[model samples]
Target: MFSYSILLIAALCGAATSDPSTSTDLLWPLPNGNTVGSDMYSLDSKTFMFVPAGKGGSSDVLKEALERYMKLIFLPSPVPALASSITAPMDKLTVTVDSSDETLALNTDNSYMLDTSMSMLSAKTVYGALKGLETFSQLVSTNSMGQFQVPSFKANDVPSFLYRGFMIDTSRHFLEMKTIMDHLDAMAYSKFNVLHWHIVDDQSFPYTSIAFPAMSVKGAYDQNHIYSQDDIAQVIKYAKYRGIRVVVEFDTPGHTQSWGKGIPNLLTPCYANDKPTGTYGPINPTLDSTWTFLHTFFTEIARVFPDSYIHLGGDEVSFLCWESNPDIQKWMKMMNYTNYAQLEQYYETKLLELVKTIGKQYVVWQEIFDNKLEVLPDTVIHVWKGGDNWPKEVYNITKAGLKTLLSSCWYLNYISYGEDWPKYYQCDPLAFNGTAEQQALVVGGEACIWAEYVDSTNFLPRTWPRAGAIAERLWSKTDFSDLHSATTRLHNHRCRLIVRGIPAQPPSGPSFCPHEWEE
Candidate 1:
C-alpha cells in the first residue's frame, strides 16, 4: 500500500503557493466548457444531497455510482466543528437523463451537458449521464481551507469514438474477480465503455463450460483458477452497471493448446521421422469433431457473454506443427491448398460462420486480414501486429471498406522506462492519411494489456494512468492535441484516481493528493 504520509509531506511543501482557482483547468478528457466566472461552488461535505431525477433506465446504477463518487470525493464526518461552521450550505447535485433504458448498445449517444451554475447533469441516455458524473467528480477539488468544491463552469462532452476499450488477457495468468472488478471500476472512471476480455489462450482456459466441463477441469492452470458460469454472470452484471460492455475472447485455432488437454485428439498430432512427436498442432481444422466441439463451445460462450461482438483471435498461427503433421499434409495435398495460410482461411471461415449462426458478430486480430480471408463486412478487424508496416496495414484495411480497431500502437504490455504514456496518448486511431470514408471505418481502439508479464498485484498500476491516456485520446476531441496541457491534466487525473482508491501510478513524476493525506 502507498503511504499517505508522503502525500501529507508533499501537500505541506506545496501548501504555501497552492492555488485552488486552478481547479477549473483540472478536468480530464478536457470537456468543451465555457467558464462562466472565476468562482467556485463549495459543497457542504456533511449535507450535500445526490438526487437522481428522470427515472432513467439506469437510475439505480447511476444512483449507486453517484453515491460512491460522493463518498470518494467528500471529506468524511468528524471534521472540526469550526471547519463545519464555515462551510457553505449543502448543494443538490442533480443528475437528470431523458430515459432510464440500460440497454448496452453501440452508438447509444453518450453525450452530456454539465451546468455548474445549476449543479445539474443532463444527457440523452443513462450512459451519457454516467460519463457526465465522472467529469463532474473530476471537477471537484479541495480549497486551501480544506473544503471540497467544484469550479463553476458549463460544459458539453461526448466520446470522439464509439468504442474506447481496454483488453485484459486473463488466460496467461488467472486474475481474481475482485481484481477484474477493480479494473472495470477504473475503466468507468476513465470513460472506457468496452472491456475486451481475452478469457482463454494457450496457457489456460479459465472459462468453465457446463456443456463441456472437462475443458476447464483439464485445461485450467488449476481447479481454483476457473471462472464458473455464475462468476461470468456476476462480472457481466457488474460491468453492465458501470456502462461497460464485456466482449469475451476465446482465441481459437492457434492458441488452443490447453483445449487439447481437456478434449483429446482435438489437435493435429505432429510427427517426426514417421513417428508421433508427442506435440500438437493448431486445432485439427480438418476434423468434423473439431467443428462439432467448436460449435458447442462457442454456443456456450455466446450465452455467457452478452455483448453483441466476440473477439475471435486469429493471430500468430505458426504452421510448423501443422507442416509436421502427415495427416494435415495429406489433406492439404488432397484439398489442393497451395499454402498454410489457405488452411487458416478455411478454419476462420468456418469459425466465423459458426459465430454468425450464434447471432453474434466477431472481431479478429490482423492475421485474418493478412491471410486475405473473405469475411462479412460487419466483422471487426483488430489491427495489432503489423510491425513497421502497421500504419499501412490499418490504412489498407479501412481503405478496403472494413471496420477496424487499432491496437498496434497501444500494446501496454511492451513496458519501457519513463513517461511512456505520451506515446500512447499521441497514437491517434485516425492518424493515417486517408479519405473521410476510410477514416470512418476506424471504429476505435483498445489498450491491450497482454497478461504474459502481469498479474493482480502489478496489473492495476501498470494498466492505469497509461491506459487513461488512450481513454482520453479516444474520448476527447481530435483537435485536442496539446501534449503539455494533457500532461498537467493527466497528472491531476492520476492523483484523483489514487484518492479514489485506484492504485494508478503517477504518469510521469512525483504527485500527491491532499485529500488522501487528510483522510
Candidate 2:
C-alpha cells in the first residue's frame, strides 16, 4: 500500500497534460508502425464505406460495425457545417477488408493499415478494419478553427499478442446485458480481442443453462438477474462482431456453492459424528452421477458457446470439505490416492476428458498443474498467482510446452491508490527470461476485475483508464515500461475514452475531458 502511495502521489502531481487526439499523440494502443503528419485535416460529407476486398462479399456484420462507428466518429451529434468551405475537405473515406470470415477465433487476424491521407483503411479481416475505424474515430477532434479535424497519417498495426483479454466475473454481482455490451464496445476500442467471462462462481450462477432449468432459478441472486439464452446469444453475437471472443468459465470441484442450490445430491455431504450434517461441499467426485451431470451440462455448453475453448476452472479446491467427508476418504483409500490433490486430479481428469469428448478444449487455473494433473495439449492454463516470482512460474509452465495467459499482475480487483496502471503496463508476459519457443507459448494476458466489490454503478469509473493501460500493454509491441511520454499519452487517452462514453476514471490523479462522457 505504501508503495502504491508513492505512485499515486506522483499521479496527483501529473494531472491533465495533453489531448491524445492531437496529431502528436493521435492514438491509443499506439499503432506499432506509424508515420504522423504535421498538420490536421478536415473531411467533406462525413461518410465512410466499410467494404470487403477481393472475392469477399457484404454482410450484416460490416454494416453494423460501420453504423455504430459512424455515430462514434461524429459523436455529440451532427457537426455544424462551416459558413464558408475550408481547404481540401475529403469527399470519401473507405476501408477495404480482404476476408469476409467474421467468425473470430484464436488465430483470427486483426492487423490493419490506416492511411488517413487517402482516407482509406485496409485489413486482412473485417475485424482489423473495425480496429482501424476505432483508431480513426479517436482521431476526431476540433482543430483551432473549431471544425472536425483529423491527422493525415499512416499506421500499420498488428496486436503484439493473439489474445488481449479482459475478464469480468458476473457471478459475484450480476451485470446487466447493457453493461456487458458497453464494455464490449470499450474492449474493442482498446484492441482487446478476448472476454474471459468468469460467468459462475461460488457466489452465484447467472448463466441460465438450457438443459438445466433449475440452475439459474435456484442459484441466481433473483429471477431477474439471470442471463437468458437470448442474452447469452446476443452477448456472443455482439462480441463476435467486435472481434472479441467470449470464453465462459464455470469453476468446479470447489467454488460450487451456487451449483448446490440448483442440483440436489450433487455436492459431497459434510458429516458430523458419522451422520449427515446437511451442509454440502464441492461436487462429489465419487458419485458417478456427478460425471453424468457434467457431461450433460458441458455438452449443452459446447453447443451454446461456439468458441473452441471453455474455461473449466480447476483452482482453489478446498481440502477442508473433502477431508471432512469420510465417504470421500474411504473412496480415496480404496483407490490408493494418498492425498486430496490426488482426489482433485481424478475429478479434473474426468472433467477435462468430458470436455474433449464434446470436441471442446479447456482452460484451467495454474492450480491444475500444481496438483500434477495431466491435461490435454490444447489446454490454456490461466496463470493467476501473484508475486515477484510470477515470471519464473510462466517460464516453467511454457518450458513444459503448455500455452498460458498471464494475469498475475493485472488483477484490477486488488485496488490501490495512485497510477497503478503503470505497474500493470509494466508487467509483460514476454519479459520473462525464457527461450523464444517458451515465450511464443505465451498466448497473451488478461486483466481480471473480479466482481465482489465491483458492479455496474462503479465498474466503469473504477476500471476505465487503468484498464486502458492494460489494453495498450497487451496490444502494442512497445516494451513494458511506463515512459514519461506514455504518462501524458495515457492521460490523453483517458479523455478520449470519456468522450466516447466509457466514463473512464482518471488514471492520472486529476483530469478533465474536453467532451464529457454524457456529451
Candidate 3:
C-alpha cells in the first residue's frame, strides 16, 4: 500500500495526481467527439452541422444514430435546461469530412488535414481510425464557453514507429479481464498502437495452452487466472475493434521456473551438490522433446495472438546445470563448443529457426546480444538498461543490421512522474551511436510496466499520464518536448483524466483537495 506522503511526494516530484478518474480519462475519448454530432454539447452551447463528404456515409450514419439516441434520452429528463444548455455549447464545433475521394477536413478554429486515403470498411481499419480520433480529441481542450477547440494547427501526420507499445507483466500478479481491458482502453487513448502481453514469466504461466493443458493449468493462480483460448480470442477481438495489436511474449529457457516446476520432464535440471534439481535451469538445448514442446507452444500462441511478432525471452540463464552435467559437457566438447555461451546461442538460434518455421517474427532482450547468439532474420531487440549513454552493446547489434526497440528511456515502472518520461520522449530511437543505415533499423519501444508491487489498486494511476507522455514521444513529432508547457497542459490533462475516470497518480507538490477547485 502506498502512503499518502509517498503519493504526495510522487505527485509533486513527478507532476502527477492521485485521482484514478484522471487516469481513466487518460485513455478514453473526449466528450466532444461523441457529443458533437449527438445531443451532448460542450459547456458553451455551441452547435455543429457535421457534413461528412462523399463515402462518409458511415460517419453520417453514426452521427444521426448518436443524435437520435441523445434526443431520446434527453427527452425524459426533467431538467431539459441541463441537456439543452449542454447541446448548445457544442454549436461552434463542426467537422466536414470530404469523402469525394478520401480526406478528413478538421476545420476547428484551427485547420488540420489528415490523409485518410488508406481508410477502409474493414473493422480493423475503422477501429484504428477511431482509436486515432480518440487520442486526437484528448489533445484538444475547451474554450471559456466550454466549447472544445483545437489550437490553430495543420500537419499531415503519420506514426514514425509502427509498434508504439506497452508491456504489462501479468505473471507477477494477475489482473482480471476487466482490468486488462481497461488498460487496453488506456493504451488506445494514449495512441499506443501495440499491447505486448507478457503472458508467461519465471513467477507463473498465466497463458492457457490447449495443445498442452499442463502448461497454464499447473502454473496459474488456481484455474481462474489462467487465460483460456476463448478469453484470448475475446481480447483480440476487443482490441481489434479499437485498432490495437496484441503481441504475446512467452518467455522461454530462462524464465520458465513455473513451467519447469510444474512439468519437471519439460525442464532441464540443475545439479545441486551432485543431485539433479527439478527447478528450471539452462534448458537441455539439444533435447528433442524440448524442441517439440516449444514448437507446440509457439503454434498455439500464434493461433491466438494475431500480431506478427512473438517475444521469445532469451535473457538471464544460469549455466550451473550445464557445467555440472558430465553427459552435457561431453556432448558440448564433441560439438567443438568451448564455452557455455555457445551452448546458449545454440539454443536461441535453433529455437528462433523453429519459430520462423511457424511464421512469426522474433523479439528478444539485449541479453541475446550479450550472449553473442547468431542473428535471426527480422529480429527486434528491446534495450532495457537505462542511462545517459547508449550502450556499445546495442550499437553492435544494430550495426550488424538488426532493428532495435529503445526501452532504456521508457520504463514506466521507474516511478518518476514526468522527469523520466520527457527524457524517453526526447531520446530518438534513430539517433543512436551507429551509422544512419544502422539506426534506420530502429523499429520502436514501449513503456514497460513490470507488475512487481502493482495490482488493480495502484497499477492504473501509476502507469497513466507518464505513459501518455511516452506515447506522445513515440507517436508525435520530437519537438513536443517542452517540459514547462507540457507541465501546464498536463495539469489540465490531470483534471480531464479525473473527469474521465482515470485513477492517474496525482501530480505531487502542495495538496489541494479537488473539492477546493471550485473555491
Clashes of 2: 1
Q: What lDDT tens digits, residue by residue, belong to model 3 across residues 182-250?
A: 777667656676788888787888888878787787888779778888888988766654556777887
1-519: candidate 2 lDDT, tens digit per residue = 001011122345665244333344546788778786644566543443444454333746677887887677666311211222233565556768787677778888889898887778888888888888888887775543556666667889888989899999999998888889989988987889999889998888998988888998999999988898999999999998888999988899889899989998788888877788888888899988888899999999998899998999888888877888988988989999989888888889889888999999888999997777888888888899957788988988898899999999898888877778888888788888999999999999999999989889888778787888888888887553546767766766776677677888877676554566672
lDDT of candidate 1 over 207-262, digit per residue (tens):
88888899899999999999998889999988988889999988878898998988
Model 3 has a clash total of 36
lDDT at position 263, candidate 1:
94
Stretches > 4 Å off in candidate 1: 1-22, 33-36, 55-58, 75-90, 515-519
* CA-lDDT, candidates in order: 0.79, 0.79, 0.59
Per-model TM-score on C-alpha atoms: 0.91, 0.92, 0.76
Lowest summed lDDT across 10 adjacent residues in model 2 is found at: 1-10
Candidate 3: lDDT of 465?
Answer: 64
Number of clashing pairs per prediction, in order: 4, 1, 36
Model 3 scores a C-alpha lDDT of: 0.59
Question: Over 4 Å off in model 2, which ranges?
Answer: 1-13, 16-24, 45-52, 76-87, 480-482
